[model samples]
Target: MWLNAILGPVSSPVIWVPASDTRKAWSSNARSSAATHREVFCSQGIFGGFMLGVKSISGMAFSFYDWEQLELIRRIEIQPRHVFWSESGNLVCLASDEAYYVLKYNPDVVARARETNASVTEDGIEDAFEVVGEVNETVKTGLWIGDCFIYTNSLNRISYYVGGEIVTISHLDHTMYILGYVAKENR
Candidate 1:
């Protein structure tokens, strides 16, 4: 059956349906925690299309769905205190209580995942991700600035990542926190 081919033996419950496309549905598994917030983001790329659905709290996981085919491409386990996407949707920045991560979107992997019903394994996820940088103190929040990310750390300092190196920006007496930042005429 077409449904079986798309979703496999395990059926997914419909989470939301776009107003225009009733035939195409969005679905997810039962969330592990009620306290955690769930969010879905969709974006188009050169290979095809994809979406990121984040289940925050308890057992946190980032589930990537093939947007064009409407299939769960893969799932990656993450424990993030906070998560945010780049304005271009090309990067996902997340921070755990003790660390920070910037995950670049992989169109090649998305294409590979589209070829099979089986989800990508954890090893595959690791292979796709590159640890661009790390921090000793907890990362409070982060925002994308061009090809780099500016992260606010627990020490009231801002750390910047560009070209695989981290630059720390500190303040003497003032408590520095990122309320908001703008890039290239209101993006």
Candidate 2:
């Protein structure tokens, strides 16, 4: 039976269990003082392949897990106010209070995870992701507009990342917050 798990109340660690069998659940300690969000992704060709993301006071972190052994393989850090995986899941787009970043998934980490059985703490996996690009701007929220451009909601304007720089695409007089966005095509 497939299972569904609910995460948290913001200031605690995450607990997850099979809906039908609560006794067989798995839990991991919180990475920071306050926990904000979590996400799961696949690690391409690794044995366990599953990776988990937890956002907290320290930063956004991704932890690799070995399903069969139920061990944490490693943890990688990405400092962003918000983060989203691309449509293809090969890239991650991030929005910080003062900048935007794009990161490509690292296959080397998977290879290392497969070769080593030794576990790593959250602070150990420092070099897991490669930065593809960045744009200096205040990003309240952001999305990957195709594979090249990024659209972000700033304080009172909509900005975009193009040609390695941030360019304002639209402006507004009133303050606004962008929660989410959708990218239609590769451009």
Candidate 3:
């Protein structure tokens, strides 16, 4: 699913491109949410496909792009939900009120996630974000007094392994998400 949003003048329609050999995907509601240029997050499926999270006019819309007979999966009931890609390439969506849910398109990963918790530790933990034991950099896992959260803004490093990289996924948010340190920086 190759959905691209081209920011033209101001009323440009959002286009959805199908990822198929035939390239036979139509654009529905092209002018949907033309008022605001909302950022769309793409998540890779475990079954060799992808899902699109777009801020439609109605609300936050999730739909399958490449799969057939695909309809809108879920419509987030938040005015402005925070959605991002998970470590497994699944969609990690969260509402402003802290309603966290993962829209998993990967059957294999979803099956595993459902059968067992992805946490490496065996202490009855579900959905644990693990930091591999091989980093030698300072990782800020707490907020200081009057501290800002964004990685670039707060000058902090968030290390999460995904897609063959230790990408900085979570920033700081004293109110919403909690930051935790897995291990100390190697000396």
Best by TM-score: 1
Candidate 2 lDDT, 81-138, residue by residue in tens: 5665565555766666777677777657755754783333445433456677876766
lDDT of 1 by residue, 1-187 (tens): 2443333233533322222232232334433211112323332111112243544334556554544444454456656656655666667666777777777776666565546623456524333444555555577767776677777777777777777688887643655667667555663
Candidate 3 on 120-161: residue-level lDDT in tens? Answer: 232222222222222223332322111112212124444343
Best-to-worst order by TM-score is: 1, 2, 3
Clashing pairs for predicted structure model 1, backbone only:
none
Model 3 stretches with alpha carbons more than 4 Å out: 1-49, 58-67, 79-82, 86-187
lDDT sort, best first? 1, 2, 3
Off by over 4 Å in 1: 1-51, 56-62, 65-70, 116-130, 172-174, 184-187
Model 1 C-alpha RMSD vs. true structure (Å) is 10.0
When 1 and 3 are scored with TM-score, the better candidate is 1
Alpha carbon lDDT of residue 150, candidate 1?
79
RMSD of 3: 13.5
Off by over 4 Å in 2: 1-51, 56-79, 116-127, 176-187
> What does each candidate score in C-alpha RMSD?
10.0, 8.6, 13.5
TM-score between model 2 and native: 0.52
Worst 10 residues of 1 by lDDT: 41-50
Whole-model lDDT values for every prediction? 0.52, 0.49, 0.33
